[model samples]
Target: MILHVANPIYDSVFKYIMSDERISKTILSALLKKEVVKVEMRPHEYVNTTRDTLSMFRIDFAATVREKDAEGEGFKDRVILIELQKTWLDTETLRFRQYLGAQYSNKINIRKDSPKGFAYPMVAVYLLGHRVGDIEEPVVYVNHDVFDYNGEVVEEGKEDPFVESLTHNSIIVQIPRLKGRVNNRLEKVLSVFDQSRKDAEDKQVLNIDENKYEDDADMMYMLHRLTAAAADSEMRQDMNVEDEYYKAIEDRDTAIMNRDKELKHKDEQLQQKSEQLQQKSEQLQQKSEQLQQKSEQLQQKSEQLQQKSEQLQQKSEQLQQKSEQLQQKSEQLQQKSEQLQQKSEQLNNIVKSLYSKGMNILQIAEITGINKDEVAAILN
Candidate 1:
């Protein structure tokens, strides 16, 4: 039967074997029967006998048996070598042989001259998990002394005839075959190690009181610790993922804020340009109005200058007509002066006649005297 024991060191097969002490005691008690009182357990230890040796080996557990008295059917003192096997290594058989030899030679103290030969037999038991197939029964091999020649078996026992008859006991228990073999408390304990069962069923099997003893509390505590550690590790991984997610969101928000600020700056620049354009348009409108007013004033000034020029031209024509009339009047006055000179001449001739007809000298003198003097002067 296979039983699990709690192993804090987590050695693969040993951890499975050491999962529960009650299970361990039950299996060990059944194997050794009445000879075994308890099992001696220790952490796996490695010793280097040689400085240059790089090899290592471990002893899983040693059994302590009670001494037997001579009542013809009592318990015998003995020690069993227990091994938990998980992997199907090719060298396992040789390694198990080596372990048996070490246990036999290294553990027991011997005297060179003592007559009592070592009577305690070292048995090796392997509790295998899942590898051994089809063979439902436990495989048992007993080592015996045999004759060999050139690495070939020649005879049954020629070298050590005395001890050859007794069999060296070894047992290999395959865990896969325990499906329907045995019932009661032992089978329930074995169900926990069977991977074929559902997890809930396995938990139910572990909770069964008939399968466990009061001494299994320590194993339960160790299992709880392992479960808690696994849970904490998972929680830490989840937290790390959450932190990365939050950091990505923060980076995205920062990028969006920068883009918004850039857009706002561009909008402000556009607004300023629009305002400048409006101001320029207003200035152009004002200039256009001023130009229109100046054009109107220039048109009025041109009309006033044209009227003044027309008045000055009319005054010049009137002055030219008056100058022509003055020239004609002067010509007429010259003609009148010529006629008056002729009349004076005629008056002078008349006076000369009066003087020749012998008129009175005093009358002629009074009437024509002044005229005669003028007429004489003209004749001269």
Candidate 2:
């Protein structure tokens, strides 16, 4: 027969184990280095409140502890808040601080002799499936410190650190770092988280030596709880729900990253297109300037042609005036020629008359002042 304990890396299983008053005291007592005599579970173990846009639903086990002395007698009862964390996530870091702050908000009356208000001592036992903060140890203890500019302890030295400072206290149990190695009772108890199922057949029992833990009843009890939890169908369903919840968160984050990447790519393409358009616009501007220069040159040539045409029109007007003056001179000469021809015709007629009156041709030519041959011809 195989002995198994449900992996405490699962919050549900961790919660189950921590909820047991006896088991939780054993674990907390080992972690706090105090002998827990009696433990009473406090009310409102889990707060489902929301803060800062985050669901403040945290699995908490508030334990009131009565420590045992060497005489096996109980001492003054102490309040310690044991928080079971399966995994530490980045978003939940702030939430974790908020949770611790919430714990500090409450005042517990511990002693009738002492003051009426005090906060509970908190011990955060993290059954981490992964490592954090480059811490190589399987178990790392963190204590709140009051330091100055230098790394010097300024708090009053007290015999008990947890009692002196309730604010600065935490214990981290990194189960993956353990790697199935057990050195102490605490490690033995935490070993259940380190165990894996025997096969992919989903068997509840772990194939480990039960004899090694037969002397340890707490380990045995834990093994029984893990086996029972594994066998439980309803519990498995609840675990499945938790798995899906975490998966959905991862899926949502991945989707956002992919969407941002796609948008960045689109922005790059748009920028390239804008640059291309700007280049084209610059080219068009250059072409337009060239066309304007050509038009200016053509306009200058047209103005030169217009000036030449005006000069030619003035020369044509001057030639027309000269041609009119020549016509007037020619008309005066024609009138003079007509008057001479009339005088000559009159003389010729007189010559003929003289000849007819028995006068000689020479006397007729002298009277007309005409040539004698011309008068003879006229007489004949």
Candidate 3:
């Protein structure tokens, strides 16, 4: 089955170099402390080639080495390739075989051009992000060699009775199955790769204890940086959401404040109108009271005028009776005419007094024994 692999973790790269080149050199150098020469580092590169119309690929990381072997012999000390795998698939074995073949081919071709026969051993290291079980050891592989009954190796196609024939050699390191079997820097690097793979599969950032893997300092640092980057991305998202939330709240508050202000303004206008209406009502009530008092006073004056009219009517009737008596006695009639003139002057004074008291023409006529039409004509 085809499997898609993800990109290598920074920790994986760091761990690979630490385990193979860095740690191996340190241990081997310490053992041969007297004859070790300078160590050199090379840059990493990725190579892709088409083999039988199918694409094949491999990555080579920086290789470091000491100048001499542990026996103080001057030798082209070390050559290594760093391989990273985000996932393991069926094609992994073939892929590694291709890498091994290419490295062997290149070395053999270079040796053929040289004056002396030289054999340089090559190491191919793979850092895997998945657990590979079913292997008895952390690093296991097949070695092709012709062995005699005494377990001695012979040269390829060279038949020697005492020597076994050597044909092919390969190594395989299963990272996940290496737990609890980590003995060297290489094993520790594999352990870190296993942990990082687990974290990636779980969809979590690596959170390893730096103190525990102090020997793999570069690996720990790389993992820490990646985890921090993820956290920072999350924090930025949260901050943006918080900012938007506050903005919405602010807008809502402003709307509420504006509505309250409008209500207050309307209330103020209503209060002013209410006060004006109350004042108008009070004025109207005062006017009504005054009109009522005026009506009462006018009614009392009308009653007094009615009483005076009855007295004046009785006096007019008496004067008519007196005139009738005078007509029967003509000599007494002239003296009665002077008496009637004095009575008419008193009646005119009473009528003037009633007119000064605000009586209407009809009321004055009724009170002063005068004809209503005659009183109206005099007033006009």
Please report the candidate that would top TM-score against the real structure: 2
Candidate 2: regions farther than 4 A off: 45-59, 62-79, 88-90, 108-113, 146-166, 181-185, 195-212, 281-380
lDDT of 3 by residue, 1-380 (tens): 11112112332333333345444344223322322333334333324221111122244432344465435566554432333322232345665665556654554323343355443433344544344566566666554566678988754544222221113334465655654555765565444444433344433233344565556554455444444444565543543443454465556557657866875686566556556655655565555556555556666789876665555555555555554454445434444654765676576567655764567778998777789886653332
TM-score for each of the candidates: 0.37, 0.60, 0.37
RMSD of each: 61.5, 47.2, 46.6
Winner of 1 and 2 under TM-score: 2
In candidate 3, position 166 carries an lDDT of: 16
Clashes of each: 8, 2, 5
As for candidate 1, its clashing pairs are 4-19, 4-20, 5-17, 5-18, 5-19, 5-20, 6-18, 6-19
Clashing pairs in 3: 146-164, 146-165, 153-164, 154-164, 154-165
Candidate 2: give the clashing pairs. Answer: 6-226, 144-168
lDDT (CA) per prediction: 0.46, 0.61, 0.46
Best prediction by lDDT? 2
- Candidate 1 lDDT, tens digit per residue, 177-264? 6644445444443444443432352221122222343455533554444344334544335334434544655565576578668756
Worst 10 residues of 1 by lDDT: 48-57
Error of 2 at 87 (Å): 4.0
Q: lDDT tens string, model 2, 1-380? A: 55544445455665676678777777777777776766665665434321112222345666666665435664676666666545534444765675566666655423233453444556766555566778877888887766668888765553253454355567877755777778876777666666443434543234556788888787677677777777777777766766666666667668657866875686566556556655655565555556555556666789876565555555555555554554555555455555665676677667756774668878887887778898865543
